[model samples]
Structures are given as C-alpha cells and as structure tokens.
Target chain A: MTPQTDRRLQPRRFLLLTLFLAGALLFGLVAGHEWASPARLARAFANSGGHDMTSQLLVVWRLPRVLAAAMVGALLGVGGAIFQGVFRNPLAEPYLLGASGGAAIGATIALLVPLGLPGGPVLAALSFLGAWGATWLVLGAAGLQGRPDTAGLLLAGVAVAAMLGAVRSFLMLALSDDTVNLQVVLSWTLGGVQTPDAGGLAILALLTAGALAVSLPLARGLDLLGLGDDQAFAFGLDPARFERRAVLVGAAVVAAAVAFGGLVAFVGLIAPHIGRWLIGPRHRALLPASALIGAALVAVCDGVARAALPPAEIPLGLVTALIGGPFFLILLMRRLRA
Target chain B: MIAVDCASVSVGRKGTSLLRDISFRLNGAGFVGVLGPNGAGKSTLLRVLAGLRAPDAGEARWNGLATPRWPARKRAAFCGYLPQQFAPAWDYEAGDIIALGAGRASAGDASPGHVLARFGLTALARRRWSMLSGGERARVMLAATLATSPALVLADEPGASLDVRHKLDLLRRLRSASTSSLVVAVMHDLDLALRFCDRILLLEEGALVADCSPDDLLAGDALDRVFGLRLQKVRRHDDHDWVIGLG
Candidate 1:
C-alpha cells in the first residue's frame, strides 16, 4: 500500500482496536464469577438497596481493581514514552531506571518509619521522592559533562536497582519482627494490584492525569529531543533543561503508579512499542496510543491473573513479563532484521 | 551583510589547545573554506564559530554581538549549523526534519516541501532518513540547514561521503547560496575549495597560518608547510583554476 493510504488506515485500525479492547475489559469485569449471569446482575441491581453480596462483590471489589490496573498501566505507558524520548534510548523504562525499586524502598520506609503518618498520601509522597532521587542518581552517574551516556545510564540504573532491591530485602528482613505482614510486602514487591479503595484509585487517577497534562504539552519538544541532545539543541531546544523536565515528569508518573499498584513490570516498555507500531513515532500520537494500549494490556493481564490460576493469585508483574518478554523479543528480532 | 569576528579564540582543557589563538573577520556574502591537516582543529574551529563551543580565552562575535550572549532562539534565527555527524534518534521523514530546522515558524515559514524540492530531494521527502543513502542523507541534512534561511551557514565536511558528481553539485550549490549568505565549510579537498570558494583559511597545529583569497592560497607555500604536501596549480583563462596535491 501507498504510505498515504497506510497512514489513513492506521488511525482507523487503532480506533477499532481500542474499542474492541474496551469492550473486552468491560466484558471481563462481569465474566469471571460463576454467579455473575445477566439475570443475576439485573436482579442484584433491582434489589440493590442493602447488603446485596453479589452486587457488592462485582461493583466494589472487581470494578475498582480492573480500573486501577488500567490507570496504573496508562501511567507506566506514558512514562515509558517520555523516558524513551528524553533519553533517546528505545530500551529506557521506569522499571529499568530503578524507579520501581526506588518506590518500593520509599514505601517500605514510609511503612516502617516512626512518623505515624497516614497511609496513602505519605506513602505516595515518599515514593515520589524516592523515584526522583533514584532517577537523578542514575542520571548523574551516567552523565559526562552534562550529557547522558546512554549505555552507562542503563547499566548504572541496573546496578542501582540491584542495590535498592537488596536494601528492600534488608528492610523486609528487619521488619519481620515488627508485625508487618510479610505476605503483603512480598506481593507488593512482586507487583500486584492490591485492589485499592475508590478514594485511593481516584487519587491515583488524578495524579496520573495531572502528570499526563504536564507531559502532553511537551510532545513536540520530546519528538525533537528524540533526535539526540546535540541535534535537539541545534533544532531549537535547550536539551539539558528539556531532558530534566521530561525525566522528572516521567518519574512522577512512575512513582504514582508504583505507589498505587506496586511494581508492575514491562507495561511501560511494551505498551509504547505497541503504540509505535500502531502509530508512528510522533510523540503527540504515540503517547496517547501507548496509554490506551497499556490500559488494555494491564486490564486484560489483571483479568487473566484473576481467572488464570483460580484461588492461588499470580502477581501481575510475572504475567506482564511472561507475556511482554517473548513478545518484545519477537518485535526486537523483527526490528533488528528490518 | 553578516560579520563574524573571532578574537584570539582558544578551546581545550588541561592546558592544551585544540584551537589556539584563532582570529578572523568576515563580512558580506562569500564562500569560505577551512583547510587543515588531521588533528589540526578544523572541526573544533567550526564548532567555535557555530557557537556550539565556548572558547576558553576569547569570544566570537556576530555583527559585533558576542555569539554566546545571543539568546538561543535569536542565534538560531540568524545562524544555521550542520554537524559532521547526523545521528537522529527517530526515523523522521526528510520533510519533517527540515520543518524542525525551520523552528517555530511553521505557520508562515518556507514549507519543507519547497526546501526539499530546491535540494532535488522531493522524491525522498517521504522516505525515512535512516533508510536513505549516505549522499541522500547528506543532501537532506544540507536541505535542513538551508531551510532555516539564516544569514550565516556553518557546515562541517558536508561533502565527506558524497561522490564526485554530488560533491561538485553540493559545492556549486553552496557557491550560489553564498551570494545571499556567508557560508563557511570545512573541507579536505583543496582543489574544490580553490575552484568554488572565494577565500580560504589554512590552519596548522591549532593556529591560523593563512587567511587569504584562493589565488593567494595557491600562490603561497602555506599549504606545503601545513599539510606537508606539494600542490600542482593549473591556471585557466576560463576562471576554473584548480590545484591538486602531489605526495
């Protein structure tokens, strides 16, 4: 097909794909339970005055978890796109940058610290600071004379993440005698949607939306930035300033996602690749498309996690990596060949 | 007319000089070629002139205003620079690349299509820059530089990877372009510089050894001293005077 014709059809295909994924997720919300038939749902809705167990189960527990998964996934996806743009490396993601590991460190510190603070906001703030700190450290270690060394940055992030992971393990070990639920902490580390309450999910949605607002306006600059720092400067951007802004915004999104949904792996990396395949590399379209794809990916993955192993719930991170890893390899192989 | 004045510009670290005590003044429209041996700081001098580097000792001024002091947007508006290497992170179309070089003037600026057509790159407008041949990519990059429509253009070895025909065509185009803007190009081809450029600057060991007309450059022994080579000069009545190096 002609490039013009291909371009015209891509948006339509993306729209159809989005609609189909939304339909599937909506169906998934009602499909898993044995008692969740259309008639039973209608009856539960009709008799929804007080103590309707099935309705509460469907509306209260499942709905929020699925939506939370989607929001967190969207956060990760957009963050990945920003990281790729700012760092000019296709392999860049918050998880790889130790943002997730940093968030875990922050959350553990918040829980185990003597501040006696409230749960949600304090945890989020700590996680945000932690994510930002870790990213800055990685950038600093990998930067030479104010310019990022891409390979060094990735390697440094990995080394720092490993160190942070060890710290987290130590924190967990130290807290074992303090009556903290090791199971919960383990699940969070392995990455699972904790089924946040409506208020918590609402706060997550707000934070993610706010981060996206700050980032969407930077789309054009990000596109120019992807051409490397020197090239971006020559093309009329202040590369150092723009890079910091993008990296900070992306870290915020990742921190918020980690605070809410734990360290869901690979969504950020894979979703943008999928989005780039659906649309081109222009950040204006790529960001939103990646978000949509990530939302669907997480929702579907959560649904599978719910239904796949029945009562023994598998963590979302395992499922994402299990699926995203091989798929990414295939895509990478294709790209390398091309 | 654009005036580029460099005053004792020196750049490097650890008390070593990559470009040392370089000074020159140019005004009006003309093509000037910078010639030097390897490690003689041709690229460094070009970067200094393009305002991509800050000299340790002195400054470069454009129209009497220090280049580093000019606001980035203002500097970009008046000066267009093309680096020796083009490593774009994205596979942008040739047209989009040029449009980016046009800056925020997308509303009323010269369309990228027009620029591509001018560079004989209309057919490659939709092609991904990474997929293009070396010569085609060079043309696209030069087209982006031209699209900025600056009063001064700084290019580093633009014709390095091009063939004989394309190199000659590129030099001819730059020669014509110099009628409206000052073009400074770093070149290894002394013959091409002599044929197309009005003036030449020869450097040795990070210092300017000669800054004179192309005829004067050929008439002197600076080339032999700087490059350690002898040149055979052929003067013609057709104004196509050329000089080539012999061992």
Candidate 2:
C-alpha cells in the first residue's frame, strides 16, 4: 500500500473512531442528567463558584463522583480490551487475574480496622497494592516451574481469587453486626460511583492515560498475537515479553479503576467482546470503541440503578451482574455453536 | 538471500527432548521438504527455524545475525510463516486476514482485492474466516502469508486440507516461488514431497537420518528405513521419476 492512501485512510478512520466515542460520551453525559434537570445541574455548578461550604459540598460532593464514574468506566473498558486481546481469549477480563478479589480483600481489611482515616484514599491505595500484588503472585507462581503459561496463569488466578473471596467472606461475617460501618462497607462492595476527591480523580486520569499510551501502540502486535503464541513468535514478536507487558499494563489499569470505582463488573468482560463483534479484532479500533461502549454501558446502568426504584438507589454492581450474567450465557451459547 | 543455520540445536523441557541435537543449512533457492513420523519433532524443528521457539542448547542464525537479534517487525517483514492451522480470535474477513500479512505497511500493500483475486478468494474476501471451508481457508491463509513477499517462507503442513488439484497447484506455485524465494515446507505426502521438493530431509526419532536430493532420498534402502515402505521409482514421459510405494 502506498503511504499516501494510508495517510488518507488514517484520518478518516480516526475521525470515525472519534465520532463513535464522542457519540457514546455525549449519550453518557445526557443520561447522567436524566434525574437532575439542566437547571439543577447548572445551579449545582454555579453554587460551587465561591469556594464556600455550599461550593465545597457541590464540587467535592457531586461533580467528583460523576467524573469518577466516567473515568473508571472508561479505564475498565480499555483495560478489558487489552486483556482479552493479549490473552487471545474472548472471555478474559480485568478480574480474571484475581485483581478484583484482592482489591475486595484489601477493602475488607480497611473496613475491619478502625483506623479513623478517610476510607476513599485508604481504600484506593490498598486496592492498587492488592491488585498488582496478586498479579505479581500469579506471575511468580506460573514462572516457578517453567516459563509463563496462559492456562497456568488463569488457573492460578481462579484459585487465588477463590481463596481471597473465602477470606473476605470470613471477615464480613466477623463484622456482621456493625450496622453503620457495615452499610458503608456494603455500599462500596456493591459498587457505586461515589464521587471521588479531586485528588483521586486526577490520579486515576493520569494512570488511565498512561496505560492507554502504553497499550495502544501495541495494537498491531496484539492482532498478530491473536493468532496464537507460536504464530505470534514466528511473526517476530517475543511472546513472553509482550505477555508480561500486557499483564502489567492491564493489571495497573484495572487496579486504578477498581480502586476508584469499587467492583463494577461486566464492563470489562462484555465491552471488548461487544466491540469486537461490532468493529472486528483490530485492536487499534477495538480499544477506543470498547472504552466508549463500556463507559456508556456503565453510565446507563448507573442511571437505571439510581432511578429504577426512585428514592432507593440499587447497587450498580448488582445491576451490571444482572445484565452481564444473561449476556454472558448468550455469548457462550453462540460460541459453542460457532 | 535468506540462509537458515541451526547448529547443535535442542529443544524441550527438563529431560523430554522434542528436537534433539540437529543441524542443517539451506542457502540457495529450492524447496526443502521435512518428512518425519508423528513423534519425530518435524513441527518443532520448523518452529525453531521460523524463530517461534528458541533452542535450549544452540541458536538459529538468519544471515549470521542470530534469530533473536533482529527486531521482530523487521524479521517478520522478511520471513513469512504459515502454521498448520490459521484460526483467528474473531471472525475476521478473508480480506482483513490477508491485510495482517502486510504488517506495518499500509492496508494497500496487501490490496485485499489483488490477493483474493490471485488466490481465487475474491468471492470470499468479505466472508468471515469461520464461514470458509478448510480448503478455502487454507488458500486464503496461503495468500496472506505470500502477500508480504518475504525472501523466506516456512509453511507447516500447508497441504493438509487441500484437495488434489489445490495440492498440485500449490506445489506448482511453490516451485515457481523457488526461482526467487527460498521455500521450506513440512509435508506429509511422500509422493507430493518427491514430486515437488528439490531436497528432502528425512527425520527419525528427532534426528536427521537422511538429507539428500529428492531423487537420491527416494532410493529403496533409504525409503524402506525412513518411511518403512518398499518403493519403486519409475521414469515418466516428462523426465520425472514417479515414486510408487508398496506397503
């Protein structure tokens, strides 16, 4: 192909991808405003201009939460795409490597300890450490006997996740009667878009950007990788190195998202598959498309959870699982036939 | 010119050796067919030579630079590899699959149109890979591998699912390719190997037992030991010997 035509198509393709993502983002913003009128949203923004008590409440209390939702949802979607592509398994997700379970354990620990520290930062830091730590453990275990094996890593992840979940359950049982504190823990566990502090949002945004920067450049390599490790190596890729980098980047992104947004499921598993179904497996396109779709899906789900019962907000995680569970079954059935 | 040199190479985990100490060099352009029994490590050797798997004891040098030294994308640009199966993760169109061969080059390099037409896959260019027959998919994969115009092509079991006509046609194409490119293929069909391969490497128990030109390798004793078959080479009107094996 001539460079001229490639250059031409590059902008056209970029525009289309941008348009798709922009459309999704716009839809998310619009849907977010469903419960609050434009006047109310405007007033909320306006009242925050003075840095007074009302401003602090509006800015710190409201805007941060909504922005956190968007940022976390976007990160999970993109992270999911990367994991699925790197593993060459349509079923792979951020939580498949035990990141979520580890994070849950960390959060459970924070909750159990009466540390008097603000829960958000402590939870975020613990979750990040837990997720990355679990990933390292899985990698270390896989590397113990021989070189890393995809199946081995997956099996290790499942085992570790189950173990962590059992421990978390035991901890939860121990704290079963602390109603006030338990409610707080339950809300976080059930996963909601609690407004993060400005500091947390900034950190998450930076981490997400870094992960995307590191991963998007590997789009072509990811395409070749989908053919299988042997084929990928034959095509001049160092599969082991690529796998390590992918795991690191994926783990980091998922950690950041979970730390900020709690245990939002389905976006990671479903977004990439749906994106692949729509745009094919070109990672360059799949990454951005999945991010948009994932963000939109979560945003819409959050909207429904907030308003579905009117006055009683449903857990965002429950809503996602309810939707994702059936969707997963349908995909599995389709894959079986194929 | 592409030259592959494997010196005292071995591959495996712990003590179970897949490909024992093996060494060979193929420099000039010609088709080299690798013939081996099921456990003889033919595919492992192919993978090693293609830079897919590293040898535990030795190394593979491509034009003296060492396989691991060259940048992956650069190496891929010059060496095309086709595996036994080409199943993609998604239902990529035949055209898209071909385009992957072009690598970092613009999508135009593998004008999906031109390649599909060349491989008689024009009608199926828009079809999902999963929708194609084994034979059709094989042809499309072959087309994709060749789209890069690499100097060396390593194909593992390229003719496994092909029909007789396609088998013959593909062999003919490989033969033509040898005029300008070095082609190494792992073949299961003894007759096809003898008919199309300029040289044949007969492997037994993960070791090179025979390395000779097709005419010489098909001799009675060598064929009997390597393939465990009694064979007769009859001269055809076309000046090529027809190898007939009797079990």
Candidate topping lDDT: 1
Q: Give residue B222's lDDT in candidate 1 (0 to 100).
A: 92
lDDT by candidate, in order shown: 0.79, 0.73
Residue lDDT tens for model 1, A1-338: 21341355777967865896686567557555242665665565566622777777877777788788888888888988987787776667788789888988888888776577797678888888888888887777777343455557778888989988999999888876646556667888888887888788888788778867887988978888866665666666777787778777887888887877788888888988777766767788788888888888888888777777766677889889898778756755764575
What's the DockQ for every one of the candidates? 0.55, 0.43
TM-score of 1: 0.92
TM-score of each: 0.92, 0.84
Worst lDDT run of 10 residues, candidate 1 chain B, spans B101-110
Clashing pairs in 1: none
User: Which portions of model 2 miss their true places by more than 4 Å?
Assistant: A1-34, A37-64, A106-126, A135-158, A169-185, A197-199, A336-338, B12-17, B104-125
- Worst ten in a row by lDDT for model 2 chain B: B101-110
Q: Write the per-residue lDDT of candidate 2 for residues B179-199, one digit (tens) a residue.
A: 777888999988788888888
Model 1 sits at a Cα RMSD from the real structure of 2.8
- The candidate maximizing TM-score is 1
